[model samples]
Target: MAEDGAAGGRPCPICEEPLYKRHCKYVCPQHGVIMDCADTFWN
Candidate 1:
């Protein structure tokens, strides 16, 4: 699995918070699961 800020180290699309890798998804502290493995990149 990739690190917290791996390939697409982008911010949350909704709130602009730092996104962290959780399992196969990217999560924002303010928002929840933002992106998953099925998706190409973190928006």
Candidate 2:
């Protein structure tokens, strides 16, 4: 399910779809919030 306040902006590197930022965190619709992606995203 889509996250609340997740308007869509950054695309997920894996799915290539828009990711939702909730509480300064990102979540993929298929995979949910990937912990490994944290470093890649912030860096």
lDDT of each residue in 1-43, candidate 1, tens digit only: 4695554456788988877887778887888888896786533
Of candidate 2, the 10-residue stretch with the lowest lDDT total is 34-43
- The candidate maximizing TM-score is 1
Runs of candidate 1 exceeding 4 Å displacement: 1-8, 41-43
TM-score between model 1 and native: 0.67
**lDDT of each prediction vs. the true structure?**
0.73, 0.66
Clashing pairs in 2: none
Residue-wise C-alpha lDDT for candidate 2, range 1-43, written one tens digit per residue: 4455464767787988887776646777887884333566464
